[model samples]
Target: MYERTARESMCKFCKYVIKIYGNQYLRKPNLNDIQQLYEVHESKHGFPEMLGSLYCMHWEWFNCPTAWRGQYLRGDHRHPTVALEVVASQDLWIWHVYFGVACSNNNLNVLEQSPLFNDIESGVAPDYSFEIDGVKYKYGYYLVDGIYH
Candidate 1:
């Protein structure tokens, strides 16, 4: 009974937080935001039009339901988990976030499901052009590790 009550309280708190700060905290960066991010990242990382660093994190679900354990299990971990892919700048401002993916999936799989490139696909992305070593390049890019292709 205590566990049930705690779970309900947690759910209510989560919903309230989302309702109050969801738009500001949990949204993709717009054109102006992207431009600013590119400038900051480029000045610091020596990469023109660079947005931010991309990474994925796995969070263990200690209270995972028994029926869904197999689907969320990653391998040999003996626990169910969920993944969160994020693109965050040096200042810790999150530009992109994709969560709730099963741990069994890899970064590429999660990326495929993410809306990271949705603006590009919809032709609403801002124009990003910069000169590097006398070579003019267009389009901003994120600094992802070898895991992402």
Candidate 2:
């Protein structure tokens, strides 16, 4: 069927892309990256220790399995869909990406399921400290819309 063939082609293309550019484009930020990110975001937004902007997008899953349709259906759309959560800098450099979440869920739900703060919780995150209006802060923050909790 056309669906099966399309799925296979997409999978193959994704594999090839990941094989070629995965490490450079998809990995988490290191210490140096964190420092630069903080500096750039702080200078532009007046928010010290800021990382980037957070947003979520929905992708219609036209090939979603019938059995899982109910779980992925968005209230606004009749089609089954999946969600992708991304955090990117002003330069459009993606720092974090979490995908495959059901579109039925809200941005907050996707965020809760994402491993965005795993390193922070495990105490392995890079050390970030900055002063905002003479107040010292140790953790980095992200610019998120009102939808986020």
lDDT of 1 by residue, 1-149 (tens): 69999999999999999999988986768878887887887788877677788898887898999998889998857678888888888899877777857788887787767777566556676665555665555544432342211
Give the TM-score (vs. native) of candidate 2.
0.72
Q: lDDT (CA) for every model shown?
A: 0.76, 0.79
What TM-score, over all chains together, does every model reach?
0.70, 0.72
Candidate with top lDDT is 2
Ten-residue segment with the worst summed lDDT in candidate 2? 140-149
Q: Candidate 1, which ten residues in sequence have the lowest lDDT sum?
A: 140-149
Each prediction's Cα RMSD? 5.7, 5.9
| Reference-based lDDT, residue 130, model 2 | 57
